[model samples]
Target: MRARNFVSVIAAVGAGVALVSGCGQGGASGSSGDSKVIKIGTLHPMTGSNAGDGAQLQHGAELAVKKINDAGGIKALGGAKLELDAGDTKGTPDTGQSEAQRLVSDGAVALVGSYQSAVSANIAAVAERNKVPFVMDISGDDAILSHGYRYSFRLQPQNSRFGATAAQYIKDITKSKGRPVTKIAYLHEATAFGTGVYTAFKSEAQKLGLAMGPEITYDAASVSDLTTQIAKVKASGANILVVSGYYRDGVLAAKAVQTVKPKLDAVIGAADGAFDQPQFPTDAGSAANGYFDVNYHLNDKSAEAKAFADLYQAAYHDKARASAGFAYDSVRIIAAALERAGSKDPGKIRDAIAKTDLNPLSLSNGPVTFDEKGENTAGLPVLTQIQDGAPSVVYPDNLAAKTIVYPAPVQ
Candidate 1:
């Protein structure tokens, strides 16, 4: 059997286990005019609290794989076709490490996942040990890069950048209105992503002369009522609210604040709100409106972004979120690097990806260049708002869909 056929057979035998173990198990057979088949593995939380996030990312990666393959496979590899193998990490750090190790052992040349930061931290060590490149799609904690893993590369900006952007936006926009920035409350989940952004935003807010208030941490898994915390923020008379966490916690936080009817000047979020998932607006009600966030895309109307968005909707019948953009950009970046490298050698691929700079595939809100620490130097993000029911870019003026709406209407 040809390698591709053998791999397919393995996959068919054990969809769950084979996904991680199918690496080089298949016989590399099939003739498509000097085309070598390259394998890339995906490790994501296929089941767990973050299952929805992982599944969405999986589809995004799949779409990218299909588009790349259809574009004549890597021409630099003499028309080599890229192959995708996926593993279920179950959204745990241990599982991420195990899945990454399995992919490397199975002969996968590169990896593309571990959507959560805690999980990505585990996967990075395994990829480093095996000399395989792990191109991250969503994980944005600064600690992921601080570890100094040479074999890892991040396609998305870090949580720190998002926090910094939030602080700066408040400073620039608030100052323009001649309003004295008073109290700022930072809210976060107990998760690593949340904690990291909390720290980043606190420091940035302080540096920008914004007074900081008590930090509010919530339980990510089960926090039904955050009324107490929201009341505290309201009592503090904070003018600014900086929230950090994924959709679930963000939704709850927003709703909690609305229930308490806080008189706040501005409400901003980090990558946690990058995707304006329906649940946020639905659950949070009018409190969600005018909620600003630092996210991947600057606006929905950029020619490049609009094209991708239309294609995404046509293909999936749903709107593309921040993770989708991260996935697409990661795939394109890896494809370009692999093509430039000209071989499936892991070390070579790592070097090529590390050297990625100002890539055209990079978004307009920022450039795409990897620092020595494996973090993207162009981490600039755009501020967006949940206006009415959709996310609209509202900062970095040229790309904004609407003017800044501060002192959001009280519910």
Candidate 2:
């Protein structure tokens, strides 16, 4: 039986290589025996508020599955190719619950995403009920792991850690220069991700002995203008601004800050809404420079980072975004768990996933090992500051690419 399995594995690998090499193979063909296909489900917002980033994440995950299948899939699973069953979450929690149920009912061995925290929270029950391992690629709600869901796994760093990273970076920079520590204002959307960051920053600031400014909350959806919110933040006489929301609000906040020209010591935030992507820099102008923020992985040129970067660029024809790395790594982590289990059973897969210790650069916030609560113990969020057009890590010395650059308030 072992000999027969070895032969099947070799045959599958050869077929996969041939297909990748552009030989006369249309696509991956299954062997005529047990372990036919490894079906996984992805619940992502193909359309809705967070669609821009969510769509990119979905594509990255799809690309990872394609590459895995092209490389002969899982040899231990009798050369079964990875197959993805994706559901459009519509970026809402209500839709997310229905989609999760549908995917589990359809017999998916594992589940991948629901980028928004609201969506993830709504679908988490379904995944738990079916014992399906839900790998979160984007949602960063603190309650995600705090609830102690055994089957839930998150590849991204927690929201609270990210908030702390950003806040600490500012605190360190100010202390080093002996600047007056006046006030810190926190801005957050009324979403789970936003609220998590808001709470963490407030707590960390108080611990650091920084004055906590009036915390401001905004509606993520339908908040076209942020004049009032910005005015309130400026009135607080805060030296630092921590915006904990999505990209749309980030743009609005940047514009509003420029118009008000408040005396801010620093402007930073958690990674959720802060990358200088597309036209953010062009739109924000000088405000884009020296903007401090935090993200899950660094876009370094190290070997591991390069390997994933090259493959991602080759497959997608663009630089991988923050969420893309999470999606790709989430699939890879799930794949490793499946390989270890040697079975499609969700219970075993969940156990294996909790034991994974990957060093993939695509998920460099830290090690991939998860504790019983499904939170990664090996990782902590990194602080970054926008220089030129990209975000480079500046905190956690080992992973950092450059020294921390404090944002000098425009005189």
Candidate 3:
């Protein structure tokens, strides 16, 4: 049976236990009643290499729950408060799946999480099997949604979208600056996350009549040094170097580029994790300057986004990253689903989520809407460049926060 409808079959069997146990009453351990509180699960790597990003995702969801509750909770459900049951995946697929199962068993009607694509895939399966709605906050690999699971949804553009957009942005910006396109070197982590992006980027770059070569790969978890990789890129005679990888490895690649001094026209990132991060400049030091990344980012021009960012900063004492914005939106989407469903039943919530049509605070092409595959067709990514020690949107003219700086100055 379809996961969305499958929940109905089990709802009856579970209702008695739910009522007797008062699920999610006391932090999902046991509480007052389902009418008083609705529980949602947040899965992320809380104590691993990606812990930094995971914490932001959790914080964003927390802030959204607080915002909704402060505004009087879900009125349709008689002011029922939303509770978050956070689970740490430790950046592993096994742990992610286990945690997802635990959260649903505890009482989460809907779930959001797992920054890494692989981890998200595992959690997606758990959600599907348990007949709970799974909303992705930031996992980008397109294959995650290729399965015909109706219970899973995504708020971010797929990796292929990020790659193609990056290629187009590079072509436009370079040509506009009178530099035009030339040879490009690609470096990415050897994982579904990085490889998925590189594959699409190379195809799109080729389609745009841009030359690509010197593709390099490294293990994000074990690789500490990228000097050898950067040296290959420098020798490739490529004028543009495109990188795709996670934060720590991305920072390592930046430092390698600095040490190697490739003298490329521009060192850019295609769906790169570190290039668009708030802490990248501080972590990569001088190596971070002039780097560009084509990926999803917060719409700084949106008044709502501005307000949200301010609140996030005041609460966390740190600038909100794009990943956090998605997390916040995920929670809001769940709340909207809860309000619309008017019931804590997982089946009803899943159906309501499938019909979501709401404006998102993130930089999107249009109001959030999901296709049959649960991909947010309205989702879009923007190009950002680290200028003046901070990343700023620099492309798409409409969302440009700063003008393009082409052929980056030599360090």
Backbone-clash count (model 2): 1
Estimate every model's Cα lDDT from 0 to 1: 0.72, 0.71, 0.84
Clash totals in order: 5, 1, 3
Runs in model 2 deviating more than 4 A are: 1-35, 276-286, 362-366
- Please, what are the lDDT tens digits per residue for candidate 2 over residues 78-170? 877776666778778888898888778766789888778989987787898889999988888888777778889877778888777777766
lDDT: the better of candidates 2 and 3:
3
290-385 in candidate 3: lDDT tens per residue?
A: 899988888877998888888777656677788888999999999999999998988899899989998888788888999999999899788888
lDDT of 1 at 279: 44
lDDT leaderboard ranking: 3, 1, 2
- Kindly report which residue pairs in candidate 2 clash with one another: 239-265
lDDT of 1 by residue, 135-242 (tens): 898888888878778988887788888778778888898888887678888888877888888788888888888899989888765676778888988988888877
lDDT of 2 at 399: 67
Best by lDDT: 3
Pick by TM-score: 2 or 3, better one: 3
Model 3 residue 206 lDDT score: 86
| TM-scores for candidates 1 onward, in order | 0.86, 0.86, 0.91
Model 2 is weakest, by summed lDDT over 10 consecutive residues, at 18-27
Which one wins by TM-score: 1 or 2?
A: 2
